[model samples]
Target: MEIAIIKYNAGNTQSVLFALQRLGYKAVVTDDKKILSNADKVIFPGVGNAGAAMQSLQLTGLDKLIPALTQPVLGVCVGMQLLCNYSEEANTNCLGIINTSVKKFVSATKKIPHMGWNTIYNFNSILLDGVKQHEFVYYVHSYYAALCNASIATTDYILPYSAMLQQDNFYGVQFHAEKSAKAGDKILLNFLQLT
Candidate 1:
């Protein structure tokens, strides 16, 4: 199957490419509208500032191209945050595929960036197939999407936030499934098998 990784100016593209390669899938990393639209599956992975990233996407016209994709689209980390309605990262607006906003972790005792491994509580999703409930997943982010109506899974560091989101053909994950272990691989495989 053809998998396209949306190549914007954001970071973390190489790691995701490597992960897909490890899964025996050679994914194409591109920003062309036609290439992205024609893919069987699309993965949006980013690790960078929201405002700047959004600006870059807008510059390349990918900001509009991504949400219009008809195939199963997956967003990881910051890519997931950008799929929401808005983000407080830079008081920025985002693709409104999911009606949620990104918020900074309010922790006086813990830490700001919710790093390391955390358990993801699965509710119900095709992406969670073969993955156990409350499975541990790797995360590294300061902002999080609040658990809204579209939330398919939840995780907690300072408080419970959306670990996974789903709306129609669009799917998003706050944690890095590419970094998470076997559970992560299962999640990717599940997304790849989406029909």
Candidate 2:
């Protein structure tokens, strides 16, 4: 199947590519509107600041193109955060594909960035099929999306927040599914099976 991985200023493209390779799938990393629009599925993988990422998407006109995609689209980490309406990180407005807001963790007890493995539960979509609840997934982010109507999964650091989100064909994961080992691989496989 034709898959496209949206290339922007965000990092982790190679990691995601490798993950797909292991899954026996090939994907092209591009910012070309025609290529992206023609792909059967698209992956938006990112690890960077929200403001800078948005700037890159804007430069390539992907900020507008992404939200309009007809095929299933997956957003990882900051890429997921960008799918929300707004983010407290860098005071930036996001793609607004999901009706939620990203907020900074303001806890003095727990560590920032919420690094390392964490359990995700409350699955509400087919994206988590064959994946058990409270399964550990790798995460490395300082900000989190607030629980909203689109939230399909939840994870906790200082408090509960969206671990996964889905609205129509758009799906967002706040964790690095490519790096989450078995559980992550299962999620990616499930996303690929979407039709």
- Which structure among the candidates has the greatest TM-score? 2
The sequence of per-residue lDDT tens digits that candidate 1 reaches over residues 10-117 is 858898898888988899988878889999999999897998889999999888888888899999999999999999999989998899899888877997688999
Off by over 4 Å in 1: none
Cα deviation at 159, candidate 2, in Å, is 0.5
- What shift in Å separates residue 48 of candidate 1 from its native position after superposition? 1.2
Candidate 2 positional error at 102, Å? 0.4
Q: After superposing candidate 2 on the true structure, give the runs of residues whose Cα lies further than 4 Å from its correct spot.
A: none
Superposition TM-score, candidate 2 onto the true structure: 0.99
lDDT values, one for every candidate: 0.91, 0.94
